[model samples]
Target: MIDPVIIRTMKTVKEIRLENARALANEGPAEFARRIDSSTQQVNQFMGPSPTRNIGDKLARRIEAAFGKPEGWLDVEHITGSDDASISGTRSAVLEKLLPEGSGNLVTWETPDDLEPDDERVWIDRYDYRYSAGNGVIQWEVRQKKALPFDIGFFKALGVRPQDCKLAQVHGRSMEPYLFNRDMMMICTAKTRVKDGLIYAVTFEDEPLVKQIFKEPEGALRLHSYNPEFPDKIIAADQLEGLQIAGEVVYRSGSGLAGGN
Candidate 1:
């Protein structure tokens, strides 16, 4: 048996991810690409620079590109690098300054002519998004350090950006015995909006759930749990503040599934 809390949280988390995989399978390349593009823009706008971190111009462009728009931007027509953005060159140039190739500790590299810029890998240690259950919009957000009451080293590899390739974590026990707590979920993070029957991050009253999301007859969302013992909950669009669908959970591994890692 898993910690009920972990189980509770991770179950919802996995539900969101599984739903994503199904959706991607259904969409065509063009439609899928468009969705990814929109997602990228939303991330860039919301997760800018973070604390004390500067959003390098190249990475910005690369992030925008990952979503599949133009090389510089997906939502906007302009190529990256306004006068302020163009201040420095690409990663090779930037890394050389901070990393100092001579320091054997860090990988050494010189910029090749074809070298392109990109975002750092962001591992899905845990999902920490917040929303109002009564009105689920991403009203607030947290990350591994904030929401996770445990230590997850996955962050060492990825740093919470598109370059990280995007990942999510399972966070409930709705799907008991199958998905437990702190399960690192691999998500494409290319989805923009919410879809029915897919597990997603939903705000319930004031808490965010990594729950499997289904549509209700009343046009509200029905958050379901696998255990059956747990009551299936319904959340109308009007009742929600907003929704943050963290793509779909593609991979599951971590404390809950693999036996207390």
Candidate 2:
């Protein structure tokens, strides 16, 4: 039989992912699978009303990383029972389930409602062209675009100017398990300083590519990925003429999912 703890955790995590996935893609499971580099069948096994797969610690970590969530986010404390109970009664029931019938103290979960956007909400432009995280992709100027609202506080904490930020969609498995395909990326265009191990949206002769940049000695540069199947690509300093750094990736969400505030 499947472990009860596994069932509880999987159910809760899948619920969270499903809620966010709707905002990310209208295509559903197939789009989600493309983002995580897993087959659609595997994604279904973990999600849906009746999940057939157990979510292990490894897979949990991968999911957290792919969606830019905090570690252990998938393992939050879950209280079992009926949904019809009042909020306070639900807490008491959960406490009863966890502790003895009469316990010393009771702890309740606080689920604050999401705040609605206000007049001062910041909106960053999102483009239609898919930025490649695998091999380079040829893309033209932004013919279509949309604006996504972001909390101004988030930008202040990152020290990034809101106007200089652009949200772009990633489109390749080259950065699988980290930056999955169809993931929405927050690119900071204010600066061009290359940092080792930091992801950047760059261009080679007008072709767009998203990769972690490492500056090598003698002015050479190396592009790296989380997947071992893809080899590192090196660009000599002399080839810098064709290279252009569009922006540095500051945040990522699975397949255009915007769980981040």
Candidate 3:
């Protein structure tokens, strides 16, 4: 016998999740996406206004930067963060912390950023791949959203678990002729062993960069740029944080090059 009250409660929760998902796709700002007017109203709707946009807020910014521009509360739920808003937290919350190490990849796919709301694809996949996102949370039917033909960001972080993250979008042409501006690349974040030659994502002087990797003896990691014009950057293996191979470039997309523009 189905309990009507329990079913109603489940429906309410599902409705909220779906409504928020829709808003997220349309507005690109989870907290501000609800057109309910007034900050207080928005806070009440979300149940937590955020203390000056701290952890969850920071993760939301990253989600917008990495995936699609924010969208709904639940959309940000499974992104990069320690709270329910982050991808990790969302799955943990609904799945009740069932995320184990070495699970499948967790890439986020979504509808195009410029698509119109009425466009059947308005609901993008932006974050968390089909397999990971469906671990046991969202219903099987609701999981049918297929982002655009442009799903991407595989590389090292594609499906690499929570701890190990080697991800950074390419900037400048220093590694040019090979990797131009806006070209995204990922490296293994584990920093396991600085083998001989493995490209890594390097952060030097607070500046993040992606370049070919090389590790030398005496505990020193080297960075070799493909563009002959740019000189190589080197640092000690222990100091590898600045020269660690976050992950390798597994997939690239955008424009029209398959990964396109």
TM-score of each: 0.36, 0.52, 0.34
Error of 2 at 182 (Å): 0.6
What TM-score would you give candidate 2 relative to the actual structure? 0.52
Ranking by TM-score: 2, 1, 3
Best by lDDT: 2
Candidate 3 per-residue lDDT, tens place, 1-261, comes to: 986663323334334443343334333234443333334323323333121222244434443454355444443333323453464344335332333333322323253554434322222232221111122222112233443332233322345443343223455767665567666443344554545565555455444566666657787756787678889877875674443233454344322133211
TM-score of 3: 0.34
Q: Kindly list the per-residue Cα lDDT of model 1 for residues 5-29, writing each as its tens digit.
A: 5332333322332222222323333
| Tens digits of per-residue lDDT for model 2, 1-261 | 986664333456555544343333335567767776787667755653345555677876776676676887656533244552254354445434644433433222232124443766786778744444333433334534646666689889888999888888877788877777878888887757887778888887666788888989999999887678888888899998777787788888774433332
**lDDT of the candidates, in the order given:** 0.44, 0.66, 0.42
Superposed Cα deviation of residue 223, candidate 3 (Å): 0.7
Residue 105 lDDT, candidate 1, scale 0-100: 30
Kindly report which residue stretches of model 1 are placed more than 4 angstroms away from their true locations once superposed.
Answer: 1-172, 187-192, 240-247, 255-261
lDDT of 3: 0.42
Tell me the spans in candidate 3 whose CA falls farther than 4 Å from its real position: 1-168, 186-193, 237-245, 254-261
Per-prediction CA RMSD (Å): 24.1, 15.3, 20.7
